[model samples]
Target: MSPEISVSTNEHKVLGACPHDCPDTCSMVITVRDGIAVKVQGNAEHPATAGALCTKVSRYTERSYHPERMLHPLRRTGPKGSGQFEQVTWDEALSDIAARLQAIAARDPQAIQPYSYAGTMGRVQGEGMAARFFNQLGAARLDRTICASAGAEALTQTLGHKVGMRVEFFAESQLILIWGSNAIASSVHFWRHVQTAKRNGAKVICIDPRRSETAEKCHQHIALLPGTDAALALGLMHELIVNDWLDHDYIARHTLGWDALRTRALEWTPERTAEVCGITVEEVQGLARDYGQSARAGQATAIRMNYGLQRVRGGGNAVRAIACLPALVGAWRQRAGGVLLSSSGYVPVQAAALERPELLAGRTPRTINMSTIGDDLLRPASPEFGPAIEALIVYNSNPVAVAPESAKVVQGFARDDLFTVVLEHFQTDTADYADYVLPATTQLEHWDVHSSYGHTDILLNRPSIAPLGQARSNAQIFRDLAHHMGYTDPVFAESDESLCRTAFGDQVDFDLLLTRGHAPLPVPEAPFADGGFPTPSGKCEFFSARLAARGDDGLPNHVPNFEPAGADPRYPLAMISPPARNFLNSTFVNVQSLRSIEGEPLVEMHASDAAARQIADGDVVRVFNGRGTHECVARVCERARPGVVNGLGIWWRKLGRDGTNVNELTSQRLTDMGRAPTFYDCAVEVVRV
Candidate 1:
């Protein structure tokens, strides 16, 4: 263990990719001296990434060397949820996890649910391998499609497929509508492209309930009410139809359900749209005409929307409403036109996830929502639902902190019936709830592939240095766990190289592709070159018969559903938890610089709202509903809409330790199919604490 092996300065250089909770997943290079990562820089040669790293990820080396990181595995010796654990060796930790998991499997394999979210979007690791392993083991299906699936389902219902155009398409787009998405704060590189498109004379329009940073740069702003996006979209379509601006020939030739759509849209004229959508009629008319009559000769006018992430209630219809825009104008027929719910390609995780039938071949039992993990543990219909969930394996997420109604998730862990296992570098909110905390190496200590949701390129991730301490990559841990579980199949027998090849399958040779940092799929040299479609109907359905058949009725049906967010006139304002540019969930809250500048968690309000409440900037205030209580500093900022309040999500209970989590108030109610929460419009009241 001596420092006998003297290495050159160049030997310290390491190559890796950013493992952020973002779609950009930019490739990076890290220079390590001794055991610590020093200089962090972008890898210029990385494909798709353009060697770009965001401010949050650029200083990741600081996160690696963060003083608060947990170095060794810990075993909770005290009562569950007591935040007490004793440091343990790797052998004890691994053996304990294996033995404990085996006991749970012996009792009921379905009890050991692997819960994870969009911490790492790559397929080879995170939930990809983990799900495959558990599926084979006949475990519970953790259907955590909480973030993107609602939009995907809506798009699939209307468009018959869920896919976005190439990132390069932004360069060709003549008109851009950023709806409920702040690309500049959430995606710095893509925002640069928006600026580029604007310079090229492509008009930009931002439609959001809040006048976000993206809205600030737009030609016009549609500050509609939360959950009202669909109404406005339908109204806009009505405007297009009234003015004869729609591509009628395109609709007649390549789409169905036009009559139904027209009928439904007529019900949403500008007057009705103004009432429901809460935007001015003039703004609605101008926004509709600007996009419907684009000068771009392409088949589609480019609109890069975030889908329905901002919905508080009526989330699914919100997705259905906005997604219908492209087809009305035949935007998909053009090069720079199409709805971008997600830029990560369809059939993600490649064919390995599809071809591997080892886990899901036979009939699997019940499925549970990711947003409702607490209910799954507490109210399983199975005979032993309460006592069966003895082991829970978590990777790439801090669900106890990130999931809606996270306080309940912690309470579920407090049950002796629920055993928690978390793989992470730090004792995250989820980790502290675990019986055993597994040491998961940072991206700086591992190798993997990057599948960006913002761009088309398949990025290659190279390990910058050796695993710090005894920490291992999630893939390595799963591979080892599979070995311990006595899975001798040829599929499980594959090495990282073989597994990655299986992951990529015949599509691309991973090792060769990794050398260049990425491999981009070839888009049609020209948009809509030939007549082809994936659905049974050989064309895009202007009005989806499938949706109509499925009883969705295809015209973005506007109906009120039971939602967690209901107004109490006493609490006149709605609380919105918007994405923070400086942080992703609770991951970067431990970092010094980002958290330092963000300061303590703050409840931001419009100046008018603040004045009405007689609240001023820097005032400590307590916000509460029937659900829970949270106290934070208040800032009078116009960023929050007049009647709406904005609070950043998952600041951590330990940081302010007095419930900084927004989930303390968010309800676990979800969509039937997509299970995504209507988080934007939850009602709450605030007062000086």
Candidate 2:
């Protein structure tokens, strides 16, 4: 349903969607006055958004109109990483960039790489035109595994896709497990549903390494060690089996390889799980009891898993184990049951049509994992590494700040030989090292389309104002670059509005989106209720034969963190770098209001650890490991557990106290299954500076 738009001679409302990397994908109404966007608010009519917006998104107007917003193309005048640039005309910038890219393509198109991820989750602006450009150029394929790849791959292995129960159904759930998610900070709208479920006498449990705000409000919190989620899941399964909580009929009819999974789960006793997860045996037993009783009583029990848990060594296995729980007691039988890591798989996005990969003309270039860009960038061309990276086109992401092992990333970006171009609204840490910085428009000045991962809604964004100054949308920037490069592909001529329509084509009701601003997909209330799981067997597979064929374990099992707590003599603590509540990664770190709210970068340590290190609250401290040292204020509080420190992060490297953020201590090591970054599985120690 669409909210009513009020219009006058001088003012009117335009419908759009929040384009940030968020699950809500909130439907927004832009109040425009005389061709200028005056205000932005959530559409009350959108069920998932529920007329509410997070602090960062609510202040989007400030971001769009910030004083430092890049309004013109800039050419770097000083050395790389010097943050020196001179304004240039769009023609000069595009022509120079195109010429450089063409020169690199002439040698080897694989030398040119396009780096981007979720700066705008909009289909049209994100990869619609940009992908076409890269494919046509036969540039190196980027394996975008920075964030959700591990969990997404796990979901695909276990659930056949990243599908899940409808998020709105959580309100009717009798029990909710907010696993590895700080719902209050990252998923505000989903927290609303949990609050509603709480009001209705439902029990809530939070499973996370950190004692997040959501954990504080939950009925129970299991502060387990990071990367131990699979063990905990197995412990719960053991309890379900030993206590006779199984749904025998569901298991027999709708599951595959249950016997093997049962055997593996049975081996994990409560004591063993407690030791591995670094929690009390009582905590494990109590949580298992709660979950089993809820399922046995035929009440709805839901799990809201987020990407945070999957940013570890064994993240994929953890997701696989947790995904098997709903089927253990037939939780999918109820609309309010089952688990939701992502609802994205339910939406049938026409990715091939949108990206036009056929433009590659049968060329298969080398793939580069974004997580290991630090190492990849420094690697010379070889038999396996292929061509050395010569040109980098960055949009939507700031790798120098967000990528792990920032020291290496910085070293690679500082190479005078590397030609780099950035499209941004501000001079980010990465942009500071750019050969050219092209101005990119904000969501308020773009035509785009979005599909939500929190809800099954396809939302459309209509530009409310013209691009400010000389800024342009990401799609427009790519289209112009394609033209300058002498590309004759007709697809490059498509307008932003036409790209938005092409995003879904006939698969979705484009007419409905045009009228209502949002349209829900025809997904069922209980999609897997009758055991149609979209898997090869048409049922939940406890053991994936496909994985077995690939020589990996078919059944999910606990894989310990590469940097386990107390394993290193010098770095006895495990560090997890979660995003600051006021910022989404590094997006709003430059916003004065949001940055003021976040204060300075912080590393939260338990009182015991603080005392041992002679560090006091608010004391300047150095958090160090083998990789690098990060300087930040130490926050000694109950929010942190013993042996674990929380380094709230994604602060720009330039904004940090010592010109280094949390990523300075993070490694470039990848996860077990998806080859994604192991951001959380880090070992570190804190001491007074």
Candidate 3:
């Protein structure tokens, strides 16, 4: 919808969208006064946003106008990682960067890698032009799997896409399983729906290793061991089968390979599942009873899953197992039933048209997984490895603080021979090592369109103010670089507004987005209610033939973590680094107000573990494993379950006690199905420092 701008002298409000890596891609109203954005608020008319904004995003004006906001390009004047630079003109920075990249491309374009993720979820700013630039250069393809890949691939294998029940329907669910998610911290909008259901006498259960804020408020909290979600899921299936609480007709008509899955599920009795999950048999049986009884009573049952549970070795199989639950109880028949990990597939994004991958001219470059950058960055050039990464263009992500095995990641970024250019709004940990730093425009000063994973709305962001200082949009920077490199493609000249229009082609109404600020897709209220899943056979697959063709197990099963709890006496405790409540990955860590709210990096441990290590609340502790060690304050609290420590993280490495974060102890090992990092599949030992 066109922004309802009531022009009064020099003040007006411009409709925009939050450009952060959050599930809630909120519709925002940037209140501008005399060409300055004075306020940012959620759009009251957007049903999903409901006029509410997260604390981090509500203070966006503070971020954009902060004294430290990057306003010009810079060239490194000191040693890499020294955080020393001299301001330079945009012409000088782009020319130098383009020349270096062109020289690297002359040898092998594949050696120049683009490192980016959901820094800005906008199609235009995120990858619209950047992807075109990289495709034209034939740079090494980045398998952007730092988040959600394991669960996304699992959904594809099981239900054919990352499609799910509508988010609004959760408000009407009678039984809700808050699986692997801390909705209060990460998905606040979804939590609103769950709260509505709670007020309506719905029962909510939180299943996670840590007693998260959401878990504390739920009717029940089952703190199972990390990476044992598949075991618990199978246990629920066992109870459902034994009690005959399943919809046999739905299972027979809307699912495939049920006999094989049932056989495997029956093997996981409550006793075996409890042992594997480090929970009581009664907890397992009780959860199954709640879910089964709700379904048998013809009440709406739903599952809201998040990425926290998929940062393990068996993450994909765990997702597949949980995704199979709704089909067993015929939950899809109701609008408020079924499960949702992501709603991205419901929107038809014209990625190929927007990115223009045909610019590659049929060249198949080697792909590098972003999750394993700790190892991949240090790999030597070989026939197998193709070429050592010569130039890295970092945008929208901070790898030094967020990627696994930070010690190795630091070593890779500190290489003197590697040419690095970072497009950023501030001097992030990754930017500290860059040869050049280019200032990128904030969401308030850019034109972009967004697709969300949490809802089915397409949001449009219009520039409320002109570019601040010498800042440029990410797309404009790439366009300038393309010009300097002498690339003469018409697509390179497309404006950001034009790129936004091309993002969805005819699938979404661009005119409606321009006028209303947001538009919803025409998706069914209950998409899979009639057994017409988007799978090959038009039904949910209990056993994925696609996996069988790839020589993997056809049926979902519990695969233990690489470093299971109690697997090694030396590192007996399990650790999970969930995002700090006030921060999203490493984005808001540098914001003063938010940082004040977070205070400092801290690790949560149960009293027993703290006592054993001679640690007390507020005492500095060393969390170390085979990989490396990180220092942080310890909080002996109930939030951390027994034998598990919750490291509130994504804090900037420089802010930590020992110049490292929890990723210092995480591994570069990939998961079972997706080549994603196992950030949570880690074992550690703690000691007072």
Candidate 4:
């Protein structure tokens, strides 16, 4: 169990960013000889990973020196969610969290919030200094709408814009539609360009209710029935409008509402969407005739997408009904068709790469939903939600095995009424509910800068070692917590080469990705002149008057709902976890060549429902309900389908802290554009004890 050691070529390779939550932000290089990093790869002039890299990022130099990483800071002397710390000294853990956050901002500056997500999505971890220490303590705002904000708020309320499409025309696609995503266990370099567009002839398919390995190496897989994918995508837009294969001059020249999307796609027929989509009436009419004949050969058919189907429950109208399938077949006028959705828009060979912190200049900070932040901190003692979340800070997150009620976020970080800090590198499940843990680094020991989730290529990480203990870099702990809370504007005049020249803002060769670590993005062979469409009636809306003042039904819709999961007729199967050990959310479960390809927390059933509950394969089982239970092992299977139950997500439970964490039987039931249900309805039953 000791493989990583590599380091040669006169070392000093240095380059960075693999920060993680990956989208293919690869770029890296690392090497770093004596100072450390050791060996890393993929940067062949970046442009959305040209030199390609995988196997959990060329083994990110064995998570720097992972032996359960996390080096200094500590402090919890057994109590605040007791994973029992002790270490201390970064000046006694920043003078004990700056004397309890300056006595909670000397009482009320919105009593501090500061939590974070993507566990490092990067843009210098969103230009650190923790947004100037949460606006010098005005705090509270932290709600990354619990996972891809319901598909980037339904593609920014129907394509006013958000990130999508661009990974170099995914090999001139001719038909790809994956949905509820599984791109070979979470975007393995966007399934290597959909297996190089199915080795050139194209046509991938997939969908999902579980059969995955990208639906067993796709050719056409379906599965269906987990929040019934907006009823099989409005019954494939009602078989692309009862077979006339509606493109009506690209929906009457560019599109807007088109008779309210043909009156809500004529109440989706095909036997009423194969009766609420359990699937098949000829597999929803052959996936709406292979996705409306994927750009009728004249072009467009790319779909690389992933955000794990916006974590379910209408997931922002299932990401505006799967990004309105390349504007219903014009496939965004081809270049390999459309919808990669974000590899940080592929970076500036031309320009624009997803900004808008409202356009940043401060002030929009009211957030909360990071999956109901441990039920808004265990219901502030139930006085109908008020005070009590006293202090939280955490960064490069881990709301206990990826939040969504993971046992009321481990009882609101094992309450004594919450204090938590985290900023980790492992010891995570939210650093076993910290009260101050700190450490950090890894990705070969930090220097960071990233962006990509399928490809645009924003790299530059460069640490490759040293500092494995008094660990640093979340931009030097938000610039030493903004010089210990004194606040210095110019947004604390940031650097890492000026946050890579403000992530190439309005580019004009914004350092051409610092000497080409990865650049290419303009995609203009006429990237739209006549087919305009940028929403507010400029076209391509499919009925979205800004989600018609938010009540929905503004077309681009698809509703089948589901995720209730607890009517307990002794638990009639239904559970699916996904995100298995290429270890994003649990930092390579203590990396050891990726925990020997996913270890522990089993369950996965199917073998005739595990031989009708006689279980077996490593049997231990439990899975329970009322709100929580977990003991795991199970794994029997027929490629999962029967009654269902599977597991692979975060898994940090190390022995009874409200037992078996599967977010204590998840289902905080969100997603109208907030997302966090993690697909497959939740009911449970499987027992073997």
- Candidate number of the best lDDT: 3
Per-residue lDDT of candidate 4, residues 1-689 (tens digit): 00123446545665565666766666666666657655688766555565667777787667667677778888677765557887867877876677777777777545567777776776665534566556555666765766566666676565565655666567667688777677666666677777887888887888777787778888878876566676677777878877766556776787677676667877888887786766669988887887776566565666665666566666577667667756766777766676755534334421122222322346444557777776777765334444567778778777677777677777777777567677877776667668888886655654445656565445555445667768886767766765666655555556545655565565535455545544445545424325664557666676677666867667766554554333357777778777674767665666766766776667688788788778888888888766767777887765577655776666566633334656677767776655555544577787888
Question: Cα RMSD (Å) per model?
Answer: 3.6, 1.0, 0.8, 22.8
lDDT of 2 by residue, 1-689 (tens): 44336588888888899998989899998898988888888888788887888999889999999999999999999999999999999999999999999899999999998899999999998999999999989999899999999998898888899899999999999999999999999989999999899999999999999999989999999999989999999999999999988888999999999999999999999999999999999999999888888998999999999998898899999999999999999999999999999999988888998899999999999889999998888999898888899989999999999999999999999989999999999999999999999999999998999999889999999988899999999999999999999999899999999998888888889888888899899999999998989789988999999889999999999999999999998999999999999999899999999999999999999999999989999999999999999999999999999999999989999999999999999998888788889999999989999
Q: How many residue pairs clash in each candidate?
A: 7, 0, 5, 20
Superposed Cα deviation of residue 558, candidate 4 (Å): 14
| lDDT for each candidate structure | 0.70, 0.93, 0.94, 0.66
Worst 10 residues of 3 by lDDT: 1-10
TM-score of each: 0.93, 0.99, 0.99, 0.34
lDDT of 3 at 290: 95
Ranking by lDDT: 3, 2, 1, 4
lDDT of 3 at 195: 94
Model 3: lDDT equals 0.94
Ranking by TM-score: 3, 2, 1, 4
Candidate 3, residue 481: how far the Cα is off, in Å: 0.1
